[model samples]
Target chain A: MTIAAMQGIVKRYGNELALDYVDLSIHEGEIIGLLGPNGAGKTTLIHTLLGMIPFDKGSIQLFGRTEKVFSHENKQKMGLVTQELTVFEDLTAKENLEFFAGVYGLKGEERKKRVEEALAFVGLSSNAGKTPAKFSGGMKRRLNIACALTHHPKFLIMDEPTVGIDPQSRNHILETVEKLREQGTTILYTTHYMEEVQTIASRVVIVDQGQIITEGTVNELIANIQHEEKINIDVSTPGDVPVERLKGLEGVKNVHVDGSTVQIISTVGSGNLDRVLSLVKETSGVVGIQAEKPDLEDVFLTLTGKQLRDGEEE
Target chain B: MTIFTFALKRIFKDKTNLIFLTLFPVAAIFLPEPEYWPLLPYGYHYFGVLILFVGIRLTGLLVEDRQKGVVKRLAAAPVTHFQYLFQNLLAFSVIVIAQCIFMIAGGVIYDHELHEPLLLLILFIVFSFTAIALSLAWNSLYRNKETSFLVFMCVIIIMALLGGIMMPIEMLPDVLEQLAVIFPTYWLAEGMEWVVMGEDTADFLLINGVLLLYTLLFLIIGSIRRMG
Candidate 1:
């Protein structure tokens, strides 16, 4: 069953196009990882889906209902864990959950039970009385998720939930998301981390330049790429090797050089590694050599001609 | 539990806000009045000044919530925009009424006699509504909490000075006195004066009607901004 569908989404800021005719469909009980670089319209798409910002043209359907304006009932069926810490610093963990639950009209024993359950799910029950002001970065992130979980929405939209936290907390959040998936909750997770998508996403959607460039399961995306093998070689004397000579080797599709290291991409069954090594040995001494199957990062680099974290430093 | 109750509970949980809201008015009752303010009742006049303080504090609370993303978080929940704003307004109204009650108690503790206690109570209630509406309207005009708070303080101080909360309106220069009527604080203070002097029902109703009009106008603008 389709949980939420966005068809032909086009969003613009003045004259700049933020989203250009984008389409996304989320299925029931599936974790769809929305992978993109900075300013790739990932946040814009999430905001549009949540009805935080209006799009120039699009139709959104959630829980099998399409509406011109999202009703409060529709909003209640969806939960958003924003990237920023949205929990109140003055309010304790339990109080924050209670406040959000009350906003959803949960009352009496139901509110208390849900708040307690959410706290326990996030592993913050011991610090339920503590305010977020004194919490570490990881604890605050967990509490942020717990606040969203108090209402128990059908579709959970997490925008980089593990952006800046300790390894333990990140793993805990990932496990919690997996548990939610087991409980039959549809999720749309957005992040720039390819490893995260590789680990938890049932399907991967790569968005770039305001549109989805490609999308599939991790293996499917990797298999769909032209190059099947990535080879890395470190040389003691890179200046001795000729770039044209390496490219001329049989089945060597692309070559990239960075100081003393050389990266070679090739198609499977190419038998290019032996020829390339023989050619390199004649000119320069090889320090190290590695050959492996392509991952999502290699696939993204091949498609976009840039690293996923490029321009993120700015 | 409705959003109103939730928000009110949150506000009460903040010990600083509770102390400021309750204690400020109580402290104002102890300030010695200047003899130059003979045209207005000093006790109610001081209470009127506290009303502006409540307005500033209430506006600050709403603006801080917006800055902290609490409003956006609530918007994503089962609550509608109208429900959110209405609850916030209702909560602030309750706070204003509590402040008024504290001011009344302060007046009694000081052995001050009000000529028309019932009329004074009615005027305070209307004034509370006006403050809530005005605060909401003002809050929608600025996005930054600090900027909104600075503006609120400036407006309240200027209004209190011109509206006779600081001194009698009759003591102002003719031009300043004429310009004072443009402020809602003037109407509030002028209405309270009428209640203190046992003015006719027609006069009392007219003043209350003007304050109500300000409340309605502000509520309309605030609601429009909120919807936008």
Candidate 2:
């Protein structure tokens, strides 16, 4: 079943268009990873869905209801974990969860039960009484997630929930998200990290300049660009390597030189590696050669013509 | 917890606020009364400024919420904007009212003359709302808490000084006295004068009415969304 659908959505900030004729649909029990560079409308789209900001035109069907204004009941069915750490610093971790649960109308024993469950889910049960002021960045981020989970919303929107944390905490958050999905919670996750999406997102949507450029599962996205093969050759001196000569090789798509490494992307099954190697051997001694399989990073680079972290914004 | 109780916890979490809440009332009570001033008690007049400062300090939590993106998160929650603002404001009023009670109790303990004690309480309660609104409205204009708060302190002190909280308004230059009405502190000082002098009921009520109007205006101005 479709959980939420945004049709022909249009949003503008003053004269600048933030979301232009965008359409996105999220289904039940699926984790959708939203990928975009800074100022590419990912956050804007989430805000529009949550009714935090108004869209200039279009209709949104949330929980199968097409309503311009989000009702209080509809709001209770969804939760958003913002990119920034927004939990109250003065409030204890448990108290923060209770406050948010109470806001969603969870009362009495139910509120207490959910608060405890959320704290345990985020692995902060032992520190429930400790205020966020003393918690590390990772623990605070976990509490931020727990705050949104106390009400147990079916639809969750997490915007870069693991932006700047240690790998262990990031893994914990990812595992928790997977657990939530296993329990039938649909999620819309956005982040700069590509592997996180490759590991967990059931479907991936790539957006740029206020439009959905492409979307699919990780393997499917990589498969679309699988026709190209990336070859990395480590040379004794990369500065003297003739990049233009390699670019002239038949079926070579692109060539990039970084430090002592030279990378050549050529058409798969083109048999151009020998010519590329011979050309590299002419200038510098070859140290190592690696034939790399395409991944989400390459797919993203090929589709958007920009690195995943290019022009990052706060 | 509800927003009101949560807000109370957030306010009292800082240990320094205890000293500000408890010790300041004693200082305000003992402030020497002016011999020539027959309108308002000198200490009570200064207490108006004290309540205003306390109101501003309490409402700074709201400003911090905006600065740190908690308001943006709250916008996505089930609570409406009205619920958040009203509950936080209600919490602030409770704290400010406690300060008022402390001032009244201090008057009794110090054996100071408090004319029309009930009316004086009403005036303090009404002004507390205005002070919260004014502080909230001031906070809406800036994003940084420290800078916004420091600048607000300077502005509020100037307003109090000019509105006769520090000295008699009649002693000011004629032009300054004419301009004093623009500050809500002026109406607050006027209400104190009404309480002390047993002014007519209609005029006394009008002072309260003007203060409420200022509260309404400030609340509207403060409600503008400044979150990023």
Candidate 3:
């Protein structure tokens, strides 16, 4: 079932358009990754969906009912984990959960039970009495997710919840997200990390310039791109390799060399591996050669004409 | 727990706030009288500035919330923005009222004579609303907490000097005296003067009413301006 849908959404700040004719939807039990570069209207879209900011023109439907704005009751069914750490630094881990849970109208034994469950969910049960001031970046991020989880909303909106943290914590959050989906919680997760979308998102939505540029499953997006194959050739001396001759190959679309590694993007049935290897063999010693499928980064670059990290095409 | 309780708890947890809460009231009781300001006792006159600092310190938490993105998160939650602002204001007011009580109790302990204790309490409470509302409005104009706080502290000190809390308003130049009336501190000093002289009750109430008007004006301005 459709959990939430935004249609023809237009949001503007003063004269600058933040969200321009954006339409997106979330489904039940699915983790929808909202991927975009900096200032791509991802956070603006979330704010508009939650009615935290007004949209110039749009319609929103929540729980299968169209409304001009979600009511207080409707909001109670949704949870938001903001990109920045929003948990109280002065309050203890458990008090933080209890305060947010209480705001959601969870009371008495239910509130207590949910707080404990959330703490355990984030693997912070032992540090429940400790304040967030002493938590490491990863633990704080976990507590941040736990605070949002206390009320147990059916739909959760996590806006770059794992932006800056240790890999262990990032993995823990990803695992937690997967677990939440297994329990039938629908999620709309936004992030700049394409690999994160690849790791867990059931469906991916790519946004650029305040619009939904393209979206699909990871494999489907990779398949839809013009270049279907990626070749990584490691050489002892990459500088001596004939980059121009490789680019001159009939099926090769792009060539990027970094350090001793040369990456080549080519058509799916290029049949140029032998000739390409011969040319490289003439100049430099080949350490390794691997033929692989294009990933989301390639797909994002192919469609958006920009890299994910720095938004540069090459 | 309600936002009110959580806000109060956060304030209490801050050790810096404890120093301001406890030390100032005791100091207000023992401070020497201002020789220039004979209309009201020195301690009573200076207590106005102490409460102003307390009010701004409390509202600084709201500024912290805005800077930290907690306010934006609250905006996404089930609670309304008005509830967040109102509950926080209520909590700050409760702290200010407690400060008033401490000042009153200090008066009793130190034998610092008060012409009318209850009237002074009412005046302090009303002035506190104006101070808190002013701080709120001031905070909305800036996004950086440190810059906003430092600039406001300087402004408050200037206001206290010109509004008759430091010296008699009558001794100021005519032009400065006319401009002094623009500040809420001026009305606070006026109210204290009425309480000390056992003046007409209506006049004392009028000064408080003016302070309330300033409070209302500042509250409206603060509510309209969005913080970071």
Best by DockQ: 3
**Tens-digit lDDT string for candidate 2 (A184-248):** 99999998788999989999998888999899999889889888788999999878998888898
lDDT of 1 by residue, A1-314 (tens): 99889999999999999999999999999999999898899988988898887899979888788864467788888898988888878778999899888777688999999999999999999999999999999999999998888889889999899988988888899999998998888899999989889999999999988999999999889888844578888998998877788888878788888999888887777888888888787788899998767788887888887678652422
| Residue-pair clashes per candidate | 0, 0, 0
Instruction: Assess the local accuracy of residue B125 in candidate 3 as a C-alpha lDDT between 0 and 100.
Output: 93
Q: State each model's TM-score restricted to chain B.
A: 0.88, 0.94, 0.95
Query: Lowest-lDDT window of 10 residues in candidate 3 chain A?
Result: A305-314
lDDT measured at residue B159 in model 2 versus the true structure, 0 to 100: 90
* Model 1 spans with C-alpha error above 4 angstroms: A67-69, A232-266, A269-289, A310-314, B31-43
TM-score of each: 0.87, 0.88, 0.89
Task: Flag clash pairs in model 2.
Answer: none
> Candidate 3 has which clashing residue pairs, if any?
none
lDDT of each: 0.82, 0.87, 0.87
Docking category for candidate 1? Answer: medium
State the lDDT at B186 in candidate 3: 92
Assess candidate 3 and give its lDDT. Answer: 0.87
The better candidate by lDDT, 1 or 3, is 3
lDDT of 3 at B110: 73
